[model samples]
Target: MSSPSSTPAAPAVDRLRSWLQGRDLAVFHSVANRHWPGADPLLPQLSRSANHGLLWVGAAAGIAAFGSSARSRRAALRGVASLAVASAAINTVGKSAVRRRRPRVDLVPVVRRLKRQPVTTSFPSGHAASAAAFATGVALESGGWGAVVAPVAAAVAASRVYTGVHYPSDVLAGAALGIGAAFALRGIVPTRGQLPAPGRPPGEAPALPGGEGLVVVVNRASGTAPATASLVREALPLADVVEVAPGGLATALTDAAGRGRALGVCGGDGTVNLAASAAATHGVPLAVFPGGTFNHFAYDLGIETVQETAAALTAGDAIRVDLGRFRPGPNGEDGADGYFLNAFSLGVYPDLVRTREHWSSRIGGWPAGVLAAFHVLRGQRPLEAELQGRRRPLWLLFVGNGLFQRVGPAPGRRHNLADGLLDVRVVHGGRTPALRLLAAAVAGPLTRSPAHAAVRRRRVRIAGLAPGTPYAYDGEVAHSGEELTIDKLPEALTVYCPMPL
Candidate 1:
């Protein structure tokens, strides 16, 4: 009884080790010879591990079992069910049609043991698809947890490569398929449960008479010197127009919500962003009364003039848009949180706010912005910032939920509100001359140009700089030194917008 068939086990283990060694050698050689040294060789390995059916099944089962309430349980089950269906459908219909090959076989292998007899068709990765679907389902049910699930699924899909099973993109496609399927299923089966017997759908107009109650958060220091409160009055009668003291928007919006169906915000991008954040939190739609120096949000949303925004309010066609939530970093206490509706800025823009605040009130916005640009060029240094866990030193960073200014000849092309993604602009700078800074500004909105490529992320984290480094949400500045964590709240706030643009 020394050992039952120890020799046989040794051969199997040796073969497996040999296979793994081959993959490692291939990966090392390919990566070493490549122009870019840091390209990840383990990606394929991780993707292959992700696609194992057992992993997804376990994930679904775990979510379903631990759900607290019946509703929660059902929602969790529905998500898992949806993901499975979607994953299968996408694999059969979408991936099968494409029939792409795995990158590991086509390119290089990091672990040879993980490699197997290559499959003929490999458009999408089943592992990635299943992982994605399950992850998505989990996310929809769990809110912030969904963000976590996606990456876990991504890792699982990556394992496919380590296991010598799928390509990088195959896993990606699978994840997409699974997530899409889950969403489709959720749409079919309402999260709130089934409807009752047929009754006429609610009428298009308001059930109650359109109330005269409106609240306006007017930033007194915004643009061409606070365009007479009288003008705002004429534009919005029956609305309580509160003149917000500098740094009073949060309280003003909370107070306004206690009294109205909609809150109108009058100011620059910063003001609108602040008001919108509050409005979204209170589950109210925001009506824009563009009075800011650079009404970028309004301009992007196609509300060209103050008059147009006012007219839309009169017409009462408000459309809903997404909102973002910002929480303090892990080390901070709870309840030290704020939200933003349009964009969040770090690094350069924050510096601009600090510089601009020092300028006299008589200066116009464009001139102030120009002056700020020059000041930043001459004095401001690029700050080290991290996003979605990736650390990099950057000149400026912007995270926008809905609309953003397009650069070049076309300056105001709007990104749709329903896309469920955040547009991140990272401006890279290195001790460039003042003339070059001016040249960059003259080039138009930095985000759209090739010089300032926008990186999109769902959850963004900024660190490696002092907290008091003045940051603005929309246009209002948060207290200096507050750490910022901005995350997308998809389809959280709804509004009525004019159809057909």
Candidate 2:
């Protein structure tokens, strides 16, 4: 049934296949006969520990928990994601495609062989794929972590051959596939280093070597503030650190800003906002130590840990960032004047924040937020307010200090903190509040619809608000008056942040 050309190719293909199989078997026997003193007991146990990807999951958890920087957490998450992709491919496609039998363990030493052998195909090693995928993914995000993980991944791959469960060619193929999966994921979702850094418009600040003439005021009530503040103190032994209770933030921030050459804040966004205002008033550069539940401003500045801030202080690295402020107009005086380093919002979000804070102590932060969102959406009505000059019902209104751009499927991130524009987003009042919000979230930063609208402006005026309406800025909720004029002070504040490479 074969043609003349096909008949000639068939024999050549068969001969090549036989040669590769013979070489694979020869290498398998060579590895089985080899003996390493400590590897006898350790290889089998290490190979067993990687079963079902449990070892990689534990390693990712350790990296996330012990590593202090945002890069560490991101690297761990990416590693797990890559491992999942590699494992899925190996199990679903690779094994089924090639029904290769397991290598014979007759030549392998009894002490090196696994007590419970695997029943899967031997053409591709799942353990090697997972280990390589995890290590490569981590290294893509953080080279230091990659260096720490590569040796363990190599050992796991070698163990598969030593145990006689997989041939050397199978392990190599799986590792190649694993590395490919990591790069594929990177193509879909680029790492932070791949994106443009946020800090821009470099500003001058004092070079406080050994933390001389620096003071940090930490909010004790903020999440992990006390412990991280202790780390900051140890890292900057010469700097003055003031740990304050919830009620004492204003006084402590004022005192520290007044005396220190450079003011430092260790807490959440709300605490950072206070420090920024104080620093601006007293004319000093601000150093931020992220010890809060969500350090939005600090993370945006690319300074996630005290050590990074300390390094920046020593090197006098800093940038100029705009400050968002809302106040009453010249003729109006009822609205309170305040500044926000992150964002300001009204309507559903403010109510949600207030409700969440009310029940956060009883339950947990995440649980309370979920409960608050459900309760607010179910019972809350649309906020009737005047946007610019038109009166309309709105579900929510958000104003950011700088332009926010979406990265992949995640929330918006600011690449240029000194862009000098306010990102204004409004969700029009509709029948279903929950559906409107969900649609806005999915629409991303550039949203324009009957239900939602997004724009960038230098200033905005919202009037005709009902008295005592709740407003939130940087996670802190408070009451607002009938009208507010939101504007930006371009390049108003100088803060310590590392320059992008």
Candidate 3:
């Protein structure tokens, strides 16, 4: 046999790996002997809980269900996405490629050892990766929840070392890897430059001389609360209150704008959309109050309740927001074309909207959406769309005034109010559009499928549609005849948002 000196050289990485492994093994041995008697029950359970990432899965689901806001749901979903990235990396790449051995049971007491020992290589701890990914991911979305879970995640990551399944270095590397995964996903996911900030934006926002000049219109018929008018008056004592019939909001807002120094509307998206037009036309600052089933616009603006909006108005904070203008036919030749404050869509999407309206009162917004999807998907058909002058069949077409986060079947939540880009998402036609949509909902927008596309632009027009095509705009429905035009009115509406978008 050749002398030991004649052996081929090992790569520098391998040498470094070995050196680190040796140093970490000593620490692992020390940790194995230092655990308290209570750890026998706690550490092993933590180890088993993170074995298949079930602990993180439950955490993500809980966050998604905590609030009715789209922001809350999206935050939970993004956390889940981070966990997936970490799990895939640790299993398919980190452990198999590095091939670091797990600590020997001889160093650990028999009672302290994990009941269901892992059989895989332990270069980096999978549990550590999951804990870091979920905690870091959730923190970025919802800070309150993130603060709540951070300590638990840290304890879980440390548990792997105490259990003797992972060296201290293994846990460290796994945490670093998991955090990196979350940052990588942040760019790919719809989070950057989203969420309105507390401040002001450039433009001619009116200075509310005082609450006396502010006119807030209350829609008593809107939302779940029975005392919307009472709430508004109580919140803004000095401001004038106008009560309008649900159907007469437009004319009342037009009449109100002509009379008051500033205009305010406390209602849902449908009422707000109408009020937005009159506010823009009369050059007045419009204050928004959140009093709807799903306050998409106000939520995006960071106003969660009437008192919050009232405080902002009292403080004279306002911002400029973009409005999406749509025309039923080419170049808006049809007089029926109008503007929307939130979102507009066609194809199977419109059907879903219509169905939701029927069941919303009975089942609530989110459940209504689920029920509508099931019924609408059964009879969904592809629509021949002329997008950017390119003809193609599509299952759904969505356009938003500003960039909205894609969380479920529909894109919801705007990050900026005046980015001047219409965020568009398309579901490509497939043999089974409904099933593909369901999968996207379960797996997220980043899931690999040949049927999804996203775009951002200033203008988009669609032609070659069948006459009387179903259309939905900001939760309301209409019929289009063979063609449509969509565009943005840059900084068209001056609204009193609680924060600068």
Candidate ordering by lDDT (highest first): 2, 3, 1
In the range 282-313, model 3's lDDT, one tens digit per residue, is 99888887666777888777777677777667
Per-residue alpha-carbon lDDT of model 2 for 13-49, expressed as tens digits?
9999999989988988887877788999898999999
Model 2 alpha-carbon drift over 4 Å, by segment: 1-20, 35-45, 105-120, 328-332, 351-382, 430-435
TM-score, cand. 1: 0.51
| The 10-residue segment with the lowest total lDDT in model 2 | 328-337
Best candidate, TM-score:
2
- Candidate 3 error regions (>4 Å): 1-23, 35-40, 106-111, 194-201, 208-261, 266-268, 289-338, 358-371, 381-469, 479-491, 497-501
Query: Ranking by TM-score, best first?
Result: 2, 3, 1
Task: Provide the overall lDDT of each model, using Cα atoms, as 2-decimal numbers.
Answer: 0.60, 0.88, 0.78
Candidate 1 Cα errors over 4 Å, as ranges: 1-211, 224-228, 330-335, 403-412, 433-453, 479-484, 495-501
Among residues 3 or more apart in sequence or in different chains, the pairs in candidate 2 whose N, CA or C atoms overlap within 3 Å are none
Whose TM-score is higher: candidate 1's or candidate 2's?
2
**Candidate 1 lDDT tens digits, 5-87:** 67668989999978865775566444433542332545544544444355556655565545322333444565567666865
